[model samples]
Target: MIDALTVALGVTALLLAAWCGFAAYRDQPTKDWHFIGMAVVALLAVVQLVIGVVRLAGGDDPQQGVAIFVAYLIGSALAVPIAAFMSLTERTRWGSATVSAAAVVLAVLEVRLYDIWGGVGG
Candidate 1:
C-alpha cells in the first residue's frame, strides 16, 4: 500500500467525520455538499482499492495475509456509500450521524490497512 495515500485517506475521512458530525450537532440531515464530500472520500477509497489489488496482482503480498487485506480494502471502499444510502433513508439528524460514524470507521480502516501491510507498528 502507498503510505502517503493511506495517510491522505485517513485525514480526509476524519475531515468528513467532523463535517458531518457538526451537521448532526446542528440537527440537520446530510445535504448535497455532504454527499459530494462523501463522493470524494469514496473515490479515494476506490483508488486505494485498485492500487491494493494491483500490488497483489504483481505478487506483493501483505504481511497479514491476502484474504484479510482484501476484505479490509473492500469494506473500506463500501463504507461511505453504504452509510450515505442509509442516511438517505433516514432523512434526519441521525442520517448525518450515520455518515459521521461511517467516516470514523473509514479512518479506523485506514489505520488497520496500514498495519496489515506491515507498517511500522504492525
Candidate 2:
C-alpha cells in the first residue's frame, strides 16, 4: 500500500509539473489536464491520510510524524482547489502562475512525505 501510494504521488507530481511547464511556455488557459492532475493528487492525499494514521497507530512512529503528516495532507488538499479558484479570478498569466504555485507546493509536499517516511537525517 505504501509503495502504491508513493508511486501514485510521484507520478501525479511529475505529470502536474509537466502540465504547468507547458502552460508556462504557452501562456495558454488551463485545460482539463490540470483539473485531472489535481483530482488525482487530491485522491492520493486522502489515501495517504489513512496510511499515515494506520502507521502511527501501529506503533511505527515516525519522527515528527503528526505535524509533518498533517501539513502534507493540508498542502496536497489545498493546492489544486486554491489554484483553480485563484486562477479563475484573474484572466491572465496569473492563471499560469497559479499552476506554477500548485506545482511547487505539490513538489514540496512530496519531498516532505519522503522525509517523514525516512525519519531523521533526511
Q: Choose the strongest candidate by TM-score.
A: 1
Please report the TM-score between candidate 2 and the true structure.
0.76
lDDT of 2 by residue, 69-115 (tens): 66776677677677777767765665766776776677677777766
RMSD of each: 1.9, 3.2
- How big is the positional error of residue 91 in model 2, measured in Å on the Cα after superposition? 3.1
**Which residue pairs in candidate 2 have backbone atoms (N, alpha carbon, C) closer than 3 angstroms, thus clashing?**
none
Off by over 4 Å in 2: 119-122
